[model samples]
Target: MRKLIAISSGILLLALSLAWWMNSRQPQPVELMPILTGQPEYCVTCHSDLPEISASHPVETFGCVSCHGGERLALDADLAHSTMRGGANPSDLSVAEISCGGSSCHTGSEADDRDHIQRVMTSVQSTYAGAIANIRYTFGAQTDLTAHQGINAITDERTQTGITALEIFNPTLESNPMIQKFGEECFTCHINAVPREGESYTRQTGCAACHSTEQHQLTTAISYTQCNTCHNRGNYDLRTMTFVERTDHLTNRLEEYYQPIAQFTQCEYTLDCVDCHTRSEVMGDGDLHSNQKDIQYVQCKTCHGTLTELPLTKTLTDPNDIAFRMAFLKPVVDLKLGDTILVTEQGEPLWNTRVLPDGTYEMIGKATKQKFNFRPVMGTACEQKPNEQESHFCHECHAVER
Candidate 1:
């Protein structure tokens, strides 16, 4: 009995020694106390391999806990992620206010152009008001083409279009079969909606839907491919109230850029969408618009002047001009004080464009970073009518065939 007890004690001693040696070989936990939060966090111990989120958001200052809520001191994987906001996507609208909101952040004064969250929430893309209005009117659910409902209920006290509020549109409650089918089958293209299951429709929700790439990094240099995920991947079949994916393979960039029925100019297919569309046009102007037409006002004449006058030019005199701020965010072009750039009819500056010393306008592509020199239609031998200056009229003469 004494010999057996001695052997058992030796075995237990060897096991304890082996356990201590294995633990010593492992890497130690790394703790970080961010300047913004001033709270100690152990997230880096597990996520040390992740790249910095962006130049605007530094890991050293923000740390992981500030943006991604979790057990800052937890070492176990499940415990650390148990309270995380939005799981893998913290910028989701459902929790974006908690994750990315403040007066200095995305939700702030509209005069400073910092009210991103409010603008996006009321944008036509989020509301889906236009499609709902059209379908409801066509199916006799409503009397006119005016929008009376949105995907979600929203209110805007300062709406310029007199559409102060919209009741939540529950298509399931409608009596029309077509309206009910629209609710069941045709409601996935909105910014908050989960994209259809496919590689072409791959995208995140809310702000990350447009700002984040597959590398888990945020960027402002968005490409046409990213927009294609939601816009050009497929078309909805109104007859059947279903979505039909594009099946025809294209042979060239122009063919791939737009649908076969589209008539676009060379620059339309060449430049990315962000190059032409202003921030207010795409992100909403803090107003509750009924349809896209009410929001989008950029025309061919916005960049290229009419035959009588050059495009509207505004010289950058203030150091705190919004154009400088926009250029700093994208960084594709260098804009300086006294440099004259084109402005939209609504007075939004085209920060990526500049008037050269030779009197020609030079535009830097927002995504491709390519330089393009263009002359206003005033000097060219173009016969565009003054009143008929819409882009579709220009396409009648300059549109490239698919």
Candidate 2:
């Protein structure tokens, strides 16, 4: 019995050693997993340990080479990186069509629901074309707003100025030093230009301007700090038409730098920029606008219940509203047919909500455990019968905690 046991132990040990040798002989992470579409990729053989970028993009399904155009089959680093579209960034507008976009992806076409590239191109934010036109016109260098006009090319054109309707201001060609200086100094924040090289957070431009957070994650629950990158930057002198660097560096409030130049009520400081700016207002609902004001024309009366009336309905039908939806898609949350009301994140009034045993009304955020309490504004202090309840008026008395 002892002899037999010894022989068995020796055989097990030899088998284990052979298995280890076989594993060691194989190339480290040489397995190329095929995705749902396109060719097999080997990029993950090296970047298998990279941090997750977002829930939207899964390395397992999309693979690195899908958005980032590189020689996927090449094992050598030089050959692999040879055809990289935008260095480490593929979402950059410069190469988005070939990188982040595809026929089924954000391919600059409205036929697909995921046409992000198409919408962003026409958006005022993407086409700083309007602002540049206005500035050049104001300087008397152009005959009209149409002179030196630049706009997004509706077709397959994809350059900095969106295929260029006409020649926008080129600092090298401009005879006026002021216009040249303005082009050099003031044009950094536009979504078209590539972000500054250093500072990863500051370097996230184009689609990343809003979707990418300070923590370097792609998310929708954005805050005021995200808006600070551009909105709360250096002061612009209205009197001299000059732009000056900010004195202080620490702050999330626009008032810290924009004070005296622009007025902000206490309400502006209390809530987030998204609180008032609806999805359409911020993201542009497939409709092109002239300027920032035209795009973000949200009024205070929209959210805060108006005088003598409530803006939102309080009735809903449950089981239809979900926990999660698309970036711009909101839940169906405003059903007037029933006794209870539920509001979707996108402000859509649909049939969804429930009734509690008690009289108080409540709602759960879509796909989240967070709850919202609904109150009628008809009897509240805001609904004075004969007076105007404008934003500036209420902000004077109801100040946010410092």
Best by lDDT: 1
In candidate 1, which residue ranges exceed 4 Å CA deviation? 1-27
- TM-score of each candidate structure, all chains considered together: 0.95, 0.69
Error of 1 at 106 (Å): 0.7
Off by over 4 Å in 2: 1-27, 108-113, 142-175, 196-201, 214-216, 238-242, 249-267, 312-324, 327-377, 383-402
Least well predicted 10-residue stretch by lDDT in candidate 1: 248-257
lDDT (10s digit) by residue, model 1, range 1-402:
999999999999999999999889766889998989898999988789899888888888999987789999988899999999999899887888888888888899998989999998888888888888888998899998778898889999997889999899998789999999999888888888888998878989888888886656887888877888888777899899899998879676676789878889999989988898988887788888878899999998999988998999899999999999889988999899999999999999999999888888999999899999998888899999888998999999999876
Candidate-wise lDDT, in order: 0.88, 0.57
Candidate 2 Cα lDDT to native: 0.57
Per TM-score, the best of the predicted structures is: 1
**lDDT per residue (tens digit) for residues 1-402 in model 2:** 999999999999999999999888755655555475557888777776677667667766777777777998887789999999777666677787787677766674553345777667666667665676666777767766642433334333443322334344466666766666666666666665654443422746667777667433566555666666666666545345466655665455545424444546554665566544655556555654445665564544444455564445444344343222342243324333345543433564322234445533454343232455555445566634346565555555554534
User: Clashing pairs in model 1?
Assistant: none
